[model samples]
Target chain A: MSEWSKNELGQYEYAGGKEDWEKVEQIASLCEKFVIDEEDELVSDEERSCYNCRFRRWTKSAFVCMRR
Target chain B: MKIFVGIDDSRRLDGGGAGEIVSLLTRTIDEKGWGKSAIPSRHRLYPHPDTGYRKHNTARSFSAEVKEQYMEELIDYACVMIKSNGTSDSNSGLAIAVPERMDNTDELIDYAYRTKETMINSDEALAMAKKPGLYIFELSGNGKGIIGALAAVGLRMTGNDGQFRGKLQLGTGEGYIATVKEIIEKSHIEQVKNMDFENLGTEESVRMGEKVKVVLLDHQYTLMVFPTDRQHPRWQTSTTNMLRIF
Candidate 1:
């Protein structure tokens, strides 16, 4: 389950809580992915994960997807 | 007089590039001082977040919006014309001419078939043609031929022959025949569907002395199919000389 909050627009929003964040950290640790140098132009592993995340799918061009 | 003209291009099966036809018609209408008219731009006037760029290409989704804009412009022009002429009925009518090609005939026919399949399909094409005093004519033939005829009449050709290559050129005479044939076929189907089979059986069987009303001018042909009964007022020769004077 995800944590929920209400914004000024009276719309419900969800975000990962401490428990969810911990789970994500554990998953990353198990994956053993190496972080690139801070100065490197290469995309971080975390950014790639964000691109493939279910949350991204929900947010991708939200207005267009809403019609479908 | 207030006239609303809707020009469609059926030169290609995918509803060929109508941009040129629309441009020519609107320019002609404006030049003649008949009244200001326009065909909607392919793209939406205002972009919506949801539609993005998709709304720009497909006429099916945007036809209503385009038509509405055209009508609004027409109404405005009509109001002006009325004020100046002191009468609203002074030769006022709508004329819609579509340039179609032989290759696209099957696609257009299929479109008509699908439209007939659905009960909700309003007979827009027929209704547009039947608008009281409005004259509507759909011109179709070999796309290249029609364009070639236009070129032959001294309208400059912009592209290479390969690019503009259309099938056979149906000169004025052949074009008239083809137009008449199309009108007859359309009328035959419509008449059979609306009228009793037995009543039309005699006429259908003989296929003799089957005459359709058509006028062949110097460079253009006009086919007028009465939407209502035989005695009803027919739409006049508005599109008769469209290509002739060009």
Candidate 2:
């Protein structure tokens, strides 16, 4: 969560690469707004992980969390 | 005849994804006896800036075999589905292509790849479809979805891109550890291979992890596994993070 930075788009982009499954899960566990995305967009098996959250839009190097 | 169906831009901020909608469409095709379809393949497009795309720009597509008479019926059904299901804020489009009718497939595939790098509009996509005698339809909203829908058919025809949506159940239940042979025999998965692209023997067993998904390789639904640790079931199903490269 500390690694997240707010982009000009106002979304919180994960500082970690797109594959940071553990970090995504750790952060998602502490947040109450995690909503799992559709199966095609999911990258983590941990259902509640940020990597699987619909609000997390993917970028070339990482992803941005759209939910505040 | 083999027909390819592609759909995109069906989700809005309210809630929905093109992949989920495509899966439901495929199921309906099967239930109605329209045709048997392969697993839906997700083809990603260029994430054009300010295009109103939610996350990444990706489209869902699948190939179905049906009688020549049912071709029009199938396309009509897909159009109706997209119109009824697409989110109000999104510009949904559907494309149906019969590759055999296309005079030049290389151009289509090249266009599909180009979409990954640049911004393309409906006019360009429409021109390409007209030249190939391909079918493209705008289901709702701004009609920009035609770009992804047409590109999806092209990329799928190439047989070299896209990750299959959802997991391929390797065992009777989720997370069931089973041998490679058992997995192949019991499920639709044709082969099991390691992450390094090495084939695992039939006797080798791997744990079906929570996300037991596959990618389209050599036109096969391949379940790729990786060695996570030195244990009895030394291998585990590859995660979406690993499969994302495809």
Candidate 3:
């Protein structure tokens, strides 16, 4: 699994690359609020994965998980 | 005649999403007998560093086969829908164009590609939308969305760029796995191919994957698949991450 880091705003950001399908699924498996985002935003093949989560906000480099 | 409808910046952080609004608008067009609309494609725009977009910097666009007589009504309805749905804080814009009447598609395409690489001003977008059959209108706020709105249509017309706004249902089966022929019969996707662009044979079975989406490639809704280590399901649907380069 990839390590999760925090931005200046304290939002949790995934350390793995955008296409890290395995790591994304591992994260989503532990979170109950993993809501699938719009099709355009989804990077992982797992439907319920955190990479597909609605609360995640995309940035230039990586995405930040908005769920508290 | 085909009418390309594009919309951007039509929602606030607490409000409805731009994609849902655009989907509703397309559904209304069909219900009102305005046209037979296809699925909307979501195009990404340049993200602002200072003022963040609630979601990603993405716009929605689609094409409809409508009669020429109802063209004016269509535009009017779209503008009203966008304005009414968006909050006072929204900086929304709507762009509509008839490809048959557009003479400067190459210029529009160039501008559309540039928007992805750098920031584009609304003035330049408005200038491009001033052609005979092209229409660009500001729905609310400062109307900077006109740039992304117009660019969405331009990218769509390129026969490449953007992903279909939603997932495709391949019917219930053993999880997400299905034969290439079965997928073709069940969905509107034009074809299925591997990452290398080689078309998958009809008899071949592949995993549809969760949240399956097709990208607009070569003017077709193509479901791109990638090879897997397992031989049973030799191919799997390409994820949005894989298709993001488009």
Candidate 4:
């Protein structure tokens, strides 16, 4: 169900842009490695969403999951 | 006296992000009765390819109203905190600006804007610190943090940059509607503006979203909105994607 592909930097970038709130929350719910980021860094309303994960590095368009 | 504190950290820094450090500093300031601090803002620097940090390229700053006699004590305490919190391999730095003591703040702001645009050298940050009105200190590592630290202070001074540290707890559920006036009183946000930066009238209604993030614009705490054309409310809180620009 995940559509992750390697970006030019060799990091796994999410196909979904930063606003896919529902999709990101679903992914984070099932992700075993999900860890909450600092309070100031949180973007998603869902505390457990991938957007709140500490391992996700923000890119210009989307974010790269560093867990892989 | 109004003073602004800016702090930056290297990617591999071990203790915490810049925001965490600022939060600790703010707490310390109030707990020690030095001064009252405001909410810290997170400023996004240009994500240049050459600058790979341990985390995101964001710095944190906050303004405080401290007593004149305790100013030196506050700065010294902040330096000590950064030293104890940062690891040996981490590069962390801070800049403290006293508006009254500094005359060349316009230059500092220009330097801050440039740091956000391109790669900056520490030497440039050091040179700028030599001028009056600003104090820059390198806490740890190779001292690569001066650029971001100075940029944080400058951007905070602009009164038009950075996102506030946390979201506003306006209401439960995302569909509740509130006018610009109501939201302002509830959230302490001074103004409501659309994505284009146009001011929303006091009577203008907005459908609140899950995350009610506030940004700094025109020297005010601003809540951003966009037209949704929904039946209940004509506007909705701007999504975080839209807020990435801050």
State the lDDT of candidate 4 residue by residue for B117-141, as single tens digits: 7778899999999898888899887
Best by lDDT: 4
**Which lDDT values do the candidates have, in the order given?**
0.25, 0.79, 0.78, 0.82
After best superposition, candidate 2 residue B99: deviation in angstroms? 1.2
Span of 10 residues, lowest total lDDT, candidate 3 chain B: B47-56
For candidate 4, give the lDDT of residue A40. Answer: 69
In the predicted model 4, the residue pairs found to clash are B11-B53, B11-B54, B102-B133
Displacement of residue B83 (Cα, Å) in model 4 is 2.2
Candidate 2 chain A: worst-modelled 10 consecutive residues by lDDT: A56-65
Model 2 lDDT per residue over A1-68, tens place: 57877766676667897667787789999988888777877666678898777776666557777677
lDDT of 1 at B45: 13
The TM-score obtained by model 1 is 0.21
What DockQ would you assign to candidate 2?
0.46
The CAPRI-style docking tier of model 4 reads: acceptable
Q: Candidates' interface RMSDs, in order? A: 22.0, 2.7, 2.8, 3.2
Ranking 1 against 4 by lDDT, winner: 4
What is the model-wide C-alpha lDDT for candidate 4? 0.82
Model 3 agreement with the true structure over A13-56: per-residue lDDT tens digits: 77885667787788888888776765566666567776677776
TM-score, one value per model? 0.21, 0.86, 0.83, 0.84
* B179-225: candidate 1 lDDT, tens digit per residue: 33333454322221111111122132111112222222221222322
